[model samples]
Target: MIQPDYIFECSWEVCNKVGGIYTVLSTKARTLQQQFPDHILFIGPDLGHAGQAAEFDEDTTLYADWRRTTAAAGLPVRIGRWRVPGAPLVMLVDYRQLFSHKNELFYEMWESFGVDSSQAYGDYDESCIFAAATGRVIESFYRFHHLESQRVVAHFDEWMLGFGLLHLRKYTPRIATLFTTHATTIGRSIAGNNKPLYGYMSGYNGDGMAAELHVEAKHSVEKKAAHFADCFTTVSEITAVECRQLLDKAPDVVTPNGFEPDFVPTPDRYPARRADARQRLLRAASALYGQTFDSDDTFLVSISGRYEYRNKGIDVFIDAMNRLRTSADLPRAVVAFVLIPAWVYAPRADLKATLEHGAPTTAPLPTPFLTHWLHRMDDDRVSNFILHAGFNTTDGERLKIVFVPCYLDGRDGIFDTPYYDLLIGMDATLYPSYYEPWGYTPLESVAFGIPTVTTDLAGFGRWAQTVVSGRDITEGVAVVHRTDDNYAAVVNESAGALLSLMRCSDAERSTIAAHCQSLAARAEWERFITYYYTAFNHALTAAARRADA
Candidate 1:
């Protein structure tokens, strides 16, 4: 078996996430380990969610403690292990404990370290503390892992791991570091389409200046990661182009994201399942959303992902829905709209948070590890929410709204849980992000034999557009653009596309689902993992020749 000395990938969102990095790593870790031969180690800020989990073996226990020394330096600390499927040397780094040390670290860095938390790391707030703490953690990892080096490759998923890449590169020249920015800070900030909302000045805290500077520092990290890492890549070619223009650093490779075929429950494998899924979901969603629909007035429309507003196209999609309902004179269809938007905050934003847990909120986590973050958490309440969708439907609305804007960390992922249950049942998906480095839902939807309607902006949509035989693409994976002057037209077209999909009888949608199944069979892990191997080999071989030179 071929193996690399080490594989390092970092995400600020780990089990306790604030963004998409968590989703990519957690979903791909199992296959990643097999491709690289069980040498992948997660570098992250655990926050508090990672305590002692059942996944840790004795040897990995040492690795857990090694990570803990820095992450929980100031707080009450414990160790946790990630239970990945194929990866043998998987380690989950928890950052919850960082909350306690933030203030002290910033104070010390200012007074003794001669570093102002505001200038680069943060300015007496989240930006400062988080960056500083994360930087320190990466610094420590090198000390711990550098001495026992073999052939190694480290990739930082986003800027959160920027400082660590530099720290390692200075001392361990042999270790190849690849930095991947799924989306650039400048790209997202500009795509935000509004300055004041996610502006450089406006921030999680009311302290405006720190937010502004944090934006700058984030851009700075992009340069550092791209310039410093041996090889760099983005999730899709579109994203790579964006990165190159934004950072003036062209990605060496464009590694597209691949979903697990069998896990997605595509249409072909489950020929008879679509009708059953739709019926089951209609009953559940009907009771969940509390709308009355006669037998004929039912349609299932869905859009799920973090709430990036302009980036994810939720508002445009909503407006499109309004048009679809208002413009045409059709029989009242039960359009069950299910929205799974991530990052549950942003009240002032047009796409304001909607949908209270109509059902009893599932009994909270054993002790609510997220007590502090609950208000800001775009957390997935799947267990309680699955039950929310479990109600009986005499008449289901054509639309079902499901909003999941946080980290679906556990087994309840869209691919893993009833989330797919909801997908298998929906007539169409609404994902119109302004800045999606890579969108996985469209791929998943197509796999379920349900065609998707996404935008060219996302990595998947951009790539799928180029694929010659999309008979392999899931049933309804249609790509839409958000740049149109008339979003209403965009919406109309998108909705019309979705309606066209529904126009197909149940069997036709299933046939489309079969095409998606064939598509997934080709998107196997066989070729995907080879890139990591190739990247590591390139880095190692390049480093070896450099030494001889």
Candidate 2:
């Protein structure tokens, strides 16, 4: 296998934790660091206040000489270490200085690579400016270090950073470029718009759909980057299919996302952590409902991700919980949590008071299901579903739904705990996604030794089906077969899967938990990082051939 002397990976989510991409990069950092040592660097946009954020610990002296040179060249950056497991070196580039040159950059891109920014709007301008800045940063570093003859790779993730790959290819043709689209822009738009994406994927035209969805600018950049990059890659086989159809390109490698075991508690501490998590979760639910819950008899489950009602299957998850509420075979009382963040106003004061003081001796608090108050409570889909569907957690109800519409970043008032802390409390997780390229939520759940129910439509779910034979919760993951037209079947299957988890005996549950951990171990970066090396070798060879030509 060929290896680059230095690897520079750029993403909009390097130190910024916006989405699953953050998880992908942060978890994989340690493995990359182990292989490359200090030779690997990450580049990201310098959101103004990033220096003060806990995720970034700045160090002005580590790269002082290069920083001075780059600053003089009109690229301002902060050298730091991302506070992930590996603590890898990071460079947060302030791209605001390039905004004034946006028009010129866009024109050059259009002339050189046919990237159309004519129909750009929303975040297009900002993202492209940042991307161009990253390209400049990489070039400046390469020149300052006199690395023209060394093997180097610049990897850009998602369409948001496509412009950087184009800029690098144009300015530094010798440096190999890799572009990975976690999900195609037009493909996600098609699914989000309630179109039958899977059913009509074969007949759909990428350009035509881009025009129809008003995503022409993003689609143009993404498609061009994929075509122009020395190596193109996506997260999973499912998304590779999307790329082949929607982006008109096939990935050189399918690099499935992986997790690090460092985040999980060690064996000696695991039991105590699990017990504490269960207690806190039960206490919070009991406080909200004005009823005590027996931790032994209550099954805690959750569905968390971006608040995409249809795409992330939040709607189906809610329906599945409703199905479980009335099922006679549900062996344990369920406290299902919807942990997706939304436009939240604040944590509910009454719930906080109850958590601080005690559960009221009287009736349950108003809006007993919500831990936080959303800004548009009247218009929120999850809130509306709970109310309209009569998800009343009465004195004797077997199922209760709690809507946690705030990011649990250890400061979300009520829980005052980070997402991972709360995630350990879940007995099972449901991610019945309709268009997930790779379902990280379910993967994260299983990594924490919690059985999960995911649909075959998700990339992770499809991968899980190949690893386990039965497709049951007993195997720690139940990959339910989901199609665009089978909403009802998906919900029923998901509910039944959860029921199966709840009904497991203590010995059976222990076996399932072991299976969960075993499955997660198979997906560690140690196993998955070879695909990345393959992609790197492909890019390097292609770039070498281009240089020869």
* Top-lDDT structure, candidate number: 2
Minimal lDDT window, size 10, model 2: 47-56
Best by TM-score: 2
lDDT of 1 by residue, 317-368 (tens): 6666655554454344735353443433322211111122234222222211
- Candidate 1 wrong stretches, greater than 4 Å: 1-3, 49-81, 94-149, 194-214, 266-281, 288-297, 327-332, 342-418, 468-475, 481-486, 545-549
After superposition of all CA atoms, the RMSD between model 1 and the true structure is: 8.6
lDDT of 2 by residue, 1-549 (tens): 789999999998998888999999999999999899888999988887544364778998888999998888788899889899888999998888788898999999999999999999999999899999999999999998999989999999999999999988988999999999999998899999999999888999999999999999999999999999999999989999899998889999999999899989998988888888888888878877878778888999999999888999999999999999988767888899999999999888888887888645356778889898888789998899878877886776889988999878888899898889889888999999998999889889989999999888899988888799636889999988888899999998898888877778999999999999999998989999999999999999999999999
RMSD of 2: 1.4
User: What does the lDDT come to for candidate 1?
Assistant: 0.55
The lDDT of model 2 is 0.90
